[model samples]
Target chain A: MPSYKLIYFDLPGLAEPIRLLFSYGKVPFIDQRITKEEWVTLKPTTPFGHLPILEIDGVPYSHSRAIFRYVGSIVGLIGKDPMENLAIDSVLGAMLDIREAIVKLRFCEDEAKKPELKKALEERYQRTYKKLEVDAGKNGGYLALNRPTWTDVLFCYNYELLRNALGIDVLTPYPNLQKVKKTVLSQEGIREYLKKRAPNPMKPKYELQQDL
Target chain B: MPSYKLIYFDLPGLAEPIRLLFSYGKVPFIDQRITKEEWVTLKPTTPFGHLPILEIDGVPYSHSRAIFRYVGSIVGLIGKDPMENLAIDSVLGAMLDIREAIVKLRFCEDEAKKPELKKALEERYQRTYKKLEVDAGKNGGYLALNRPTWTDVLFCYNYELLRNALGIDVLTPYPNLQKVKKTVLSQEGIREYLKKRAPNPMKPKYELQQDL
Candidate 1:
């Protein structure tokens, strides 16, 4: 296999899905976590000055979604057909929309505006989760298909972020989404990876390992 | 061949790239443009209540990027290898980032906040365009490859939006990006489609067809 090294912040923000993909496939990779200070010096050298860059065989590539899809392809976590992939990708896009809103709310400096942002985010997630819950239910506890795909793996990380980082049990209302989390965590490779993975420094109160 | 029907606003926002892909491949598809009034009734019927839904063989699919990639694959505009696709997808992701920022700036209701949002968008596009310029130069007037890909086609629409909707000649500083636009516009299928496509109702002042 080509040498793989994933570079990102220590947090399980965007890179966690990719890490899970590699671990699930039993593909060994160097998980290079960098500090903000180091990122300052290394920023200009990056393709888009973004984190969660995956270097494949010494060639670096950026964009977390792009990296996630690439790793997913390698790990056999992708769909069997174009339509199947499209179904998975659409869910991925929805998840990204939710993630972006959360990031915007988290980084907003205006304290008074936080409530509005939070409310907007809450509304968006509610609409999105309701739709996703239906999909998960129809797909037998998977996000896009009856079998677990990378999107389900991504949902697992997103679930962790919603609960631990945002301190909201967003999945409580969506039993199928909760089952998605369970189904993903139940994977032997994922369980093993979570058992050994480092606790997220940013949100230490609830680790994914505890759930596994 | 599967029957294709694309539903979106009359404006060439997210759906244009999918149209371009279908046009490039000489694929016949129903271009279903709906009014805001119609969308209000149709909203609840949609999977995610979003537009640019592509129905393949009567099966409706949402998410523009997902549809774009699916159409691109059919049109043979996708990269040849996994790594090559990664490169193209990275550029596409960057373009999405730019588009999202533009959308945010456009929708900002606060008069005082508009300037700040515009300035932030300006800084972001400048940084992003500079990086894209280098990629275009290396790829011989294409964003991610020596030959035009779906991203090059998307860039054509994005170029028009930057110039018309935003009223910014953002490509003037970047000769390579300008060349990329020229290269994409020169494609026979693209040229034909642009020549006959309806003028964007929102931005009638400048149309992509005028460039062709």
Candidate 2:
């Protein structure tokens, strides 16, 4: 067995899909999670000062998408054709678009600015959800190449992350996305992986409703 | 020659490298650019409400980076090994990081936020430039596996975009980037391509001078 180690914060923000991929593919790996304080200290030493570094046989690789693709290739999930690969990539870009917008919301200081930001983001999410729904409809219920691939795994993780972190009912907005999430989550290996894993460490703050 | 038509707004932002790759490789393609006003009218009909769609014999492919990679593969740019391909992708991801930061700064409403954003961005740019410099050094100045490839063309276009749009003088901070940019720009076909192409239409406002 080839030795693999995934180094990241003790969170599921970016590395969860890779972990899920490894699990679904039955590839064993060491999951190394660092605390927030440790990230501050250890980040600069990592390639590109980022986490979610994958080490295979002691060689380090950076960039979450690239790492996901690498592991996905091993799991036979990355698409088989160039156009299929491109379709997978387009969906990933939308995921990043949502993530960047949410990051902006995370960094905003004033409460007054948040409503406006939230509205803007909600609008963006609605549009994105529509696109994903259309793609899902056309691509045989998967994002690309007519089968459950890495893009499906990615969509599941992203949808679940938004639910766990944003506190918003993402599925309420797009039933197709909700269905996609449920379908992927129900997959045999993925379900088994979820059964063994602990509660998500990256759960967002807003999931808890405030007591007025 | 395979028939292909690349559609984009009349700007050199994301579509130029693909254009340059096709040009440099002497591959025939339809360089279709629409006006910004036309984009405003037509975007509602587009699959993702964005331009730079490549039509291969009439079937449209969206996403700039994906199209670039597809064309790059045909033109012999994508590397052989997964590791090498990931390295190339990291550079592309870093370039997007810089572009997203720039885009955020462009739309920020509060003037007070501009200064900190610029400072934060310069720090990020320094990080990218440093790593890219070292990577280029290790690879003898090209950001590709062997000879100059589409990745180098993309990097060259990135440098030109920064110099022309942002006007931040990044080359001075990382001399190696400047050298790599110079090397790619001075290539025989690339130099000719630049000379013949019109100046890019969408110039950055550079409006936050007081904050700078």
Candidate 3:
């Protein structure tokens, strides 16, 4: 197996999925977390001036989604074929759209704009989740497949983020999505990782480990 | 071969890459262009309520990037290995970052904030292009490899957008990127497609066919 080293901040933001993938496969890696002060100096050295870089063997690679896909390939969590991958990528894209809206709301500096942003985000996610619920129901409690895939894991993280970060229970109205989270959490490797992983510094109250 | 149908607006915004891929491979697809009036009726019917949906043998798929990757795979423009895909995806991700900044700037409702957004976008693209220049130089004019991949085609479209939409000649500073554009435009299939494809409704002045 190739040596892997993942570098990011201490938070369980974008890098958490990569870490979960590594843990799911029981693959050994150096999970290097840096402080904001250190990131100021390290940012210049990174390929795209971003965190969550995975160094395979010795070469550094950026882009969180790219790294997630590569790691998913390594862990046998990715789709079996091109068509299957298309399914996975579609769901991933929808989740990302919601995440983008949440990020926009989180970073809005104007106090007067928060309610409108939050309202738009609610509408967006509700619509997306309605479609995702049907997909999960058809796939037998998974997002892109009958069996668990990396997208299910991604949904689990997103579920946590919506709850902890935004104080929203995004999965309650959809039983199938709830099932997707349960299926992902039941995986042995994931369960073990959740138990041992560090709490997200930003949102300490609702870690996945708490559920485990 | 499966019957492919690409549905999008008349503008060559997101769906152009998919169209270019099909045209490059000489694959037949229904290039369905809908007006804003048509979109109102079509939006709720779409899987994710978005334009640029691709129906593969009658099953519709949403998400532009997902469709792009699927078409790229069908046309044999994707990477041969996971590592190669990492390279392609890294460059694709960078280009997407720039695109996002451009979109944000374009949609800014506050005229007073446009200057700050524009300055930030300029700095962002310049820094990104410097890194991409070295990569293209190393790859012998392509963004990810020695041969043109789908990302090179994406760059060509982005190049046109930057030029005609934003009135910025993005490739002027980077000879290697200019070479990349030349290399993509020289492809027989791509050249044919450009020669016959309809002019971008949004940026009619700088249609890529002009370069051909």
Worst 10 residues of 2 chain A by lDDT: A203-212
| Candidate structures ordered by TM-score, highest first | 3, 1, 2
lDDT of 1 at B36: 94
Q: Where does the lowest 10-residue lDDT sum fall in candidate 2 chain B? A: B203-212
True contacts kept of 2: 0.37
TM-score of each: 0.92, 0.86, 0.96
| Number of clashes recorded per candidate | 0, 1, 0
- DockQ scores of the candidates: 0.66, 0.44, 0.75
Candidate 2: tens digits of C-alpha lDDT, residues A35-107: 8898888778776777788888887777788787778878888766666777777777677667667767777
Model 2 clash pairs are: A165-A204
lDDT of 2 by residue, B51-134 (tens): 788888787766787787778777767767566777677667777777767766767899999988777767777787788888
Task: Kindly report which residue stretches of model 3 are placed more than 4 angstroms away from their true locations once superposed.
Answer: none
Pairs with steric clashes in candidate 1: none
Q: Which candidate is the best by DockQ?
A: 3
Candidate 1 segments exceeding 4 Å error: A110-116, A165-168, B111-116, B165-168
lDDT of 1 by residue, A1-212 (tens): 89999999998888999999999888999999999999999888888778889998888899998998888888888877778889988989888877877888989999999998888778778888999999889988888888888998888777776665467678888999999988888898899999999777775566677777
| DockQ-superior candidate, 1 or 3 | 3
Under CAPRI classification, how is model 2 graded?
acceptable
